[model samples]
Structures are given as structure tokens and as C-alpha cells.
Target: MTAVLSARGWTGSTFRSLRTRNYRLFATGQVVSNTGTWMQRIAQDWLVLSLTNSPTAVGITTALQFLPMLMFGLWGGVLADRYPKRRLLIATQSCMGLLAAALAVLTLTGTVRVGHVYLIAFLLGLATVVDNPTRQSFVTEMVGESDLRNAVSLNAAIFQAARLVGPAVAGVLINAVGAGWAFGVNALSYVGVLTGLLLMRPAELYPSPRVARARGQLREGLRYIAGRRELVWPIVLVGFVGTFGYNWPIILSAFAKDVFHHGAGTYGVFNTLMAVGSLAGALLAARRTTTRLRMLLAAAAGFGVLEVVAALTPWFWLFCPLLLVIGLLGLTFNTTANTTVQLACSPEMRGRVMGVYMLVFTGGTPIGGPLIGWVTETYGARDGLAVGGAVAALAAATVAAILAFARHDGTPVSIRSAVGTLTGRRA
Candidate 1:
């Protein structure tokens, strides 16, 4: 019996978090909800392209969707710490659903305009400012710290898996019915997550202490991050990569239309193929027991290099395989950074720390998206991709060098240390 049970546990090790009832429910709900989310994403991007055949317009839409995170992301973290995360998610999710529904009505009624898309995207961004942090921190409540990394990896896997399905389905719907139907489906999909939240067994939750109300808590969170080299470095790296490296929606759409001379169906295929690699990366991450700084840095650099090479590929057939590699490295870097930051922070401060993480990661879109869009618009798609890739690789190298200097000095590295090392002075 002991041997049999041990074998069973080993067989289930990669999915250990699902053994917890709460995480299981959360994961199930998310699978459905995430699929819908991806569908809407594909549909929305296609809709913008249809409304205005400019990649710059699509970039603007992406930027608007993420702009609120820049403005309110940290405050969202404060709320995550102050309130019950599950309840917070319900409110945010509901708001997002309604927004999707409203957009669907506009599109289906033939009243949708570029202005309407921008308005709804901004509204969705506002909801996500709260939802992103709360949903990220809530994993700890569902599955304790012992299994947190696994749970995070599993979450990424679910998201990528949804990516595989959602885009394909959305492509078909967009071609046959309309983009509006995709939005309508996404609006309905929120019910699954909301229902799961309601069904959760509160007693089973591994609750962390709610942060006591206090002044300057946000500043405290910032100070905490400033002091931790592990947290600070990864966050900085993600900011650069996230801003310049992960503008796939724009890049892929440009490739499909301009380079490949294809339509929404081909765009969907690219996304789906990329997700295949992403899902592989996420599953691989799930098997790892720890997050390493070296792995994060290496993956980021590799992702950048891959993108650069992919940009230079002349044929769509060649581009597809390159996207697979890019997807794998991109997801690997993302999962490692997310797991590392969340695991490194104190429970009381995880929300705010993650808030900062999300801010740098998504908020940078406003700055990077338009710049990349302009590059693509002015120079061409390949040049735009190359620019982003070069910047991402350069950022990784800079962070890696700083980290090496810090290690050599046997201290947590900062800007001062980097400057001192460069100038040959004591830091």
C-alpha cells in the first residue's frame, strides 16, 4: 500500500496543486474563462484591422487597453492586500464581462467605430488593473506556498492551452459570423469563473493574513522591492522585455497582412502555433521545483535573439517554426520571472510586489506599442520586429552584467553598484 501510494503521488507530482480542492475549481473555471478571453483578443485585433487597415491603430488599441494599469496598477495591488482576493476577482470579472457584452452589442448592431473600440479597451484596462494583481495573489490562497510555483506554472499552461483553442475558434467565427459573435461568446464565458468562485469552499482556502490598513503602504511596498536584488533585477528585466519584446499581436498581424498576404485565418494559425510552443514551455516549467535567476536571464536573451531571426525569415513557412521557438522562450522567461517574484516576496506584500510587476510588464505597452507601431509603419514589419528584438537582447545583457558584478562583490546589486563597478570605485 505504501509503495502504491508513493507511485500515485509521483505520477501526480506535476499536477500536485490540483489535489487541493480550491485550486482545482479555480483552474477549471479559468480554463473556460481564459479561452473566451483569447477569443475576444483575436476578434478585437481583427476588428480594429478591419475598421482601420493600419497596424498603428491596432497598436493604439493595445496601448489603450494597458494604459490604466500604468495609472492604477499599484493601487490595485493595495486593494488586493486589503480585501479578500476571491471576492475582488468576482467584481472585476463581472465588470469585464459587461464591457465585452457592450462591445458585442455595438459591433453586432453595426454601430461600432474606432472610437468605440478605444473606449471599451480603456474600460477593460481599468478592470484589469485590479483583476490582474488580485488573480495573481489569489493562487496562494488556493494552493499554499509549498505548491505555489507549480500552481503558477499550471496557470500559465491553462492560459496557453486556451490560446491554442481560442484563436482558432475566433478565426472561424470572425470569418463566418462576425467579430461581434466572438465578443458575445467571451462575455458569456465569464460566468464559468464567477460560478467557480461562488462554489469554492471557503474553509479549504489557505488564507494569508489581510494586510492591516496603514499609511504609506504603497511606499513601503516600493521600498521593499528596492532592497531586494532578486526582485528588483527580474522586475527591471521584464519591464524592458515586456515593453519591447512582447508586442506579438501587432507583429503577427503585420506579418499576416503585409508579408504573408493572408487573412484572419492565417493570423489565427500563427497564434495557435505559437501557443503550441508556449504550452510546452509552461508544462516544462511546471516540472521544475525552483525558479532561477540564470534561467530567467538566459530565456529572455534567447527569446530576443529568436525574434530577431524570425524577423529576418523571408517566407511564412520559415516564420512559423521561428514563432514556435520564440513562443517557447517567451513563455519560459515569463513563467520564471513571475514565479521568482511571487515566491521571493513576503505574503503580506506579495500583492503590491506583483502589482509593480504587472505595472512594468503590461503598463509599458503604452510606451512600447506605439513606438513599435511607428517603426513598423515607417520602416516595414521586419525592421520593427528587429528593433524590438535588439532592444530586448540588449536589456538582458545589461541586467546579466549587473548581476555578475553584484555576485563578484558578494552583495545585492543596484544602480550604484553597477556605476561603481563601471567607474572602479567602491559602491
Candidate 2:
């Protein structure tokens, strides 16, 4: 009876966020849109690789897509605060759909070039700068504070679930037709999101008051983060992990084409398996009522350790399962970091806080993508992945030390002892 009750409790929690009507609608749209997004991701990376026969070109595409986040992500958060999230999302999502359509037309018409890809990627990045933060902060409006964490976890799960379907379909599409069809499908997927957004009842939303336009708004957000030591460490940790540890498009593609001598099918399979693990991790995260610093740090360390293991394996069979574990730990770290930052800040500041959080988290991709791509090109895929894992692991340790320093009472404790205190074990 006890076991039955426990199982029931866990099962119920896994989909608790869907109880809210608005969230259910939002999620319904996201599942389709997210699936399309993943399809595009796989298709885009593969497209770049085929066009140039260079992993570096793939990295350059990635860099171009995320470069705007490094430049204008925070301002996006400012807009989220100053405007209604739903309305902002409508505009951004429309822009994204149009961009996808344009790319599809180019690729389908046989006039596509690497230069055209670079430009479209940059335009998409511009749309994302606003969309990312507003979408994140909008969750608070949908489910309120009580279910915020669950919604975030479920959102991750939904995205990963789509990932499972997206890449597989993209692989088939690429093989049977061409990459252009995948882009076309993704462009159509936006209809789901737009429909959901349009159907939402304005009265149901828990909207934050719009901030009046003022000078130093951007600086204000920075100061808000600077004053909170607790908030600072997670951002720092995610920045390093995101920049170094999350270059899968570069490393995995290189492994598929150059190292394993496989084609699009194997690449799609690798992504699907990782999506399986990511979905599991997100579902597990949703069941939890709270998260601790120890859990977040542990996930970060595990992700790094597993990436190194994945890099070292010479057998193709062994490499596949390693990606699953890597995906699980990676998603765990991301969801925890995201929920932590959001829960710690006040409502008025939530948008900017999430913006800054995403800035470091994804903005660093531009720098990491090209560097890792070059490393793969020069030293082989194995060494490139190993280098990234090392950096991530070291960054996790550094952040752990920072946490120790911040939390230590003014006692004469060694760094090791302080670290032990945070991890609840002897260092």
C-alpha cells in the first residue's frame, strides 16, 4: 500500500503543471513547436556540414545564431518587463516562423549557400533574444510561484520528448527528400504556438506590472544580480558549463562523420538516445518539490565526468549509452540552475534576471562553438571533447569553492572543510 501510494504521488507530480488551463494550452503549442525546433537544429547542422564538408562551418553557424544573445539578451529581458509577455511572444514567434520559411525556400530552391545560412542564423538569434526571457518569465504568470519549478521541469521534458521525435523524422526527411523539408515543417509548427497564444484568456493571466521606461534600466538589472551572492554562483557555473560542456553539435557531428564514418542516420540515432535520457532527467526533476545547491553541483560534476568518459571510448556501442548519461546530467543542471535563479528574484526583476541567466548560459555558445570546432578539426574529435569536459569539471570545482566561501560563517575553516560543509561530506 505504501509503495502504491508513493508511485501514485510521483506520477501525479510529473504532470501537475498541466492542471492549469493556460499552461496546458501553452504546453500543447510548445510540444509541436519544440519538435519543429529540434528538427531544424539537426537539419541545420547537417546542412552546414554537407555544404562545406567542414565541422568549423557548422560551428560558425552555431556562433552566428547565438551571438546576439551575447550582445542583446539583457535588453530582451527589459522588454519583457516593460511589455506584456503574451503579446511580445506573439511577435517574436511570428518573426521566427517567417525566418524558418525563408531558409526553407532557399534550401529547397537550390540557391542556398553558407553565407545565406549565416545571415538567417543571425536573424533567428535576434528573435530569440526577446523570446527566451519572455517565455521563461511568462511561466510565472501561467502557473504562479507554487508550480513554477514543476512547469519548468515539464517544459524541459516536453522539449526533450519532441527532440526524440524531431531528429528521427529529420533524418528520414533528409535522406528521403532533403534538408529543406525539415525547415518547412518547422516553419509550419509555429502555427501551433500562435494558435495557443491567441486562444489564451487575458483575464486568466497573473501579469506583472509593466515597468515605465527609464534610464539605467539595464544597469539596474546588473546591480540587482551583483548584490546577490547566492545568485552569482549559478550563473557563473552555467556560463562555464554551457560554453565548454554543451558543444554537442560540433563534437557529435565530428564523431559521426569523421570518427565513426557514419551518415545522417547515425547522427539522428545519437540525438534520439540522448533525448531519451534528457526526458527521464526532466521527469525526475519535476517530481522533486525543491532543489539544493548540492544537487546542482553534483549534476554539473557528473555531466563533466561522463563527457570525458564518452570522449575516451573507442567503441561505437559504448559511446551511445554515455551520451544518455551526459544528457541526463546536463538537463538536470540546466533545470536546477534555471529554477534557482527564477525563484530567488522578485517578480518585477524576474524577466531581467532570467535574461541575464540565459545570456551567460547560451550566449557563450558563440565563443565555444568555433573553438571546439577548430579543436575537433585540428586534434581529432576525441581530444576536442576531452578538452571541453576538463574545462567543465574544473569550472564546477571552482564554483563549489566559491559557494564554500560565501556560506562559511566567520570561523577558521580551511577551504576543504568549507567545501565539505556544502557537499555534506568530508572533502
Candidate 3:
């Protein structure tokens, strides 16, 4: 009977979080909008590449989209703590839709320039400065703490699932008609999210009280994280891993082109496998009722180790399959860290915490991408993966040791013994 219960929990449908009416609506809208978002991403890139024929132009567009999050993400989190997330989401989502619509119009009209693409990309990034945190913290409001982990997992699954479908569909659209129609479809996708927001019953949401306007709220949020060990380590782990480990675009493409001796086709295959593993990992996370710090450490370390192993694999078939395991570990680390951080903080500060969480998780990419690219170019793809994986694993182990090195029962714990216990072994 115990085994049966365990099996059921492990394999249960991840869609259980969708049982809440408000969340169900919100999620429904997100899936549609996310699909469109991914579509626009591919089409936008294709449009830029077509205009300038320069990979540098493509990189700049990518950088512009993420720069706002790095710059204003904390401020966005501050706003989330100060206002209603639903209203904020509504405003942000609408702005995003309008931007997509404008881009569609520009592209379809045959007057679009690379400059136009760059400006819009930056503007869209600006919207996400608020949207990312508001959307993240709002999950707790939608489902409360009991179901928060499940909801977060479902969110990851949805994004990855859309990721799987969106790019392929966008490729078809771009090839069949043009990038313009893809943008148009993405613009229409906003209707789903907007309708979801408009229809959500305000009374059902478990909102944190709005933060009073204050001068030092940002510093307060930082201090909140600083004093708490649980919060600090997870965010640090994400920063190390996100910056060094998650730059797959640079590392994987290099592997496919230089190592595998294939072109865009192999690159797509590697990405698809990664997405598939991520989706599976997310579903696996949705089944567990509890989130643990130990799980985060394990997954983070495993992710790094797998990258090292993947980098050294000599055969193409061996390298390809390793990516799936690496992808799984990557998503597992991400979801665990996300759930842990959100659960560890106070309701009032959830927004700020998540904003910081996202800032490190994504903002590092700009830094990591170029650094890893240079490493890959200078050495090889194998070295790039090995170096990134090593950093992630080392960060995970370091955090574990830090977490373990505390006094217990009025006695000091040695680092070696503490790390062993923290990592789930008896010393």
C-alpha cells in the first residue's frame, strides 16, 4: 500500500493545479500567449537575420530583449510588492500584445528595418521587467502555499511544451508565407491571456497586502535575502549555473556544427531533446508534494556533472543521448530552486525575491553567452561544456558546504561532516 501510494504520487497528472478556477483560466491564457510569444521569438530572429545577414545583429537583438530584465527587474519586483499582480499582469500583457501587433504590421508592410526590430525588442524586454516578477509571485496567490510547487512545475511544463511546439510552427509559417503572419498569429494569441485576466474572480485571489511606498524598499528586500540562508544559497546557485551552465545556445550549436559536423538540422535536434527532457523533468517535479533544499543541491550538482560527461563523450550518438539527461538535470535544478526560493520568503517580499531570482537566472545569460562562446571558439565545444558544468557543480557543492557549516545543539559542526549531512549522507 505504501509503494502504491508512492507510485501514484510520482506518476500523477501534473494538471492537478489547473483545478483552481482562477489559475485554470490564467494558465489557459498563458499557454496560448506563450505559444505566440515563442512564435514571435523565432519569427523576430528570422526577420532580423534576413534584414542584416549578420549573426551579430541577431545577437544584439537577443541582448536587447534581456537587458531590461537585468536593469529594471528589481524595480519591477518592487512594483509587484506595491501593487496588485493581476492588474500589473494585465497592463504588461497588453503592452506586449500591442508590441507584437505593431511588429506584425511593420513586417507585413514591407517597410520594416533591423532598427525597428531592435527598438521593439528592447521595449518588449521593458514590459517583462514587471511581468516576470508579477507573474511569478502571482502563482502563490492563485493556488496558495499548499499547491504552489505544483503550480510552479506546471508553469515550467507549459513553457517547455510551448517551446517544443512554437519554434517548429513558426518555422513552418515563416517558410510557408512569411514572418509577418507569424507575428500576426502571435498578436492574436494575446486575446487568450487578456480574456483570462478579465475573467479571473478577484475575490478568489489570496493577495498579499500592497507594500507601502517607501524609500528603501529595494535595500530592504536585499537585506531580507541576505539574513536568510535558505534564500541566499538558492539564488547564488542559480546565478552560477545560469551564467555558466545554461548557455546551451552557444555550447550546443558549437557541438552540432564543429563537433558533429552537421549544421542547423543537428542544432535543432539537440534543442528538441533538451526541451523534451525539461518537460519530463517538470512533470516529475509536479508530482512531489514537498520541496527540499537537498533536492536543489542534488539536481544542481548533477546538472554540472552531466555537462562535464557530455563534453567528453567522443561518439556522436553518445553525445546526443547525454544531452537528454543533462536537460533533465537542468530543469530539475531550475524548478527546485524556483519553488524553494518562492516558498522560503515572506508574502510581502515574494515579488522582490522572485524578481531577483529571475534576474540572476536570465541576466547571466548575456554574460555567459559571450564568455562561453569565446571559450568554445578558442578551445572547443567540449571544453566549453566541461568548464560550465564544472562551475555549476562546484557552486552546488559550495552551497552545500555553506549550508552545513552551522552550529547545531550548541556545538560547531565541521565543514566535512556538515556537507555530508546536508547532502544526505551520515558523517
**Runs in model 1 lying further than 4 Å from the true structure:** 1-10, 409-427
Q: In candidate 3, what are the lDDT values of residues 44-132, reduced to their tens digit?
A: 76676567744445556766777888888899899999998999999999999999999999989998999999899889989999999
Identify the superior model by TM-score, candidate 2 or candidate 3. Answer: 2
Worst 10 residues of 3 by lDDT: 1-10
Which is the better candidate, 1 or 3, if ranked by lDDT? 1
Residue 20's lDDT within candidate 3 is: 76
Rank all candidate structures by their TM-score, best first, as comma-separated numbers.
1, 2, 3
Residue-level lDDT of model 2, residues 59-147, one tens digit each, is 99999999999999999999999999999999999999999999999999999999999999999999999999999999999989999
TM-scores of all predicted structures: 0.94, 0.93, 0.86
lDDT of 1 by residue, 226-311 (tens): 97766788899999999999998899899999988999999999999999999899889999996667788889999999889999
lDDT of each: 0.89, 0.89, 0.81
Worst 10 residues of 1 by lDDT: 1-10
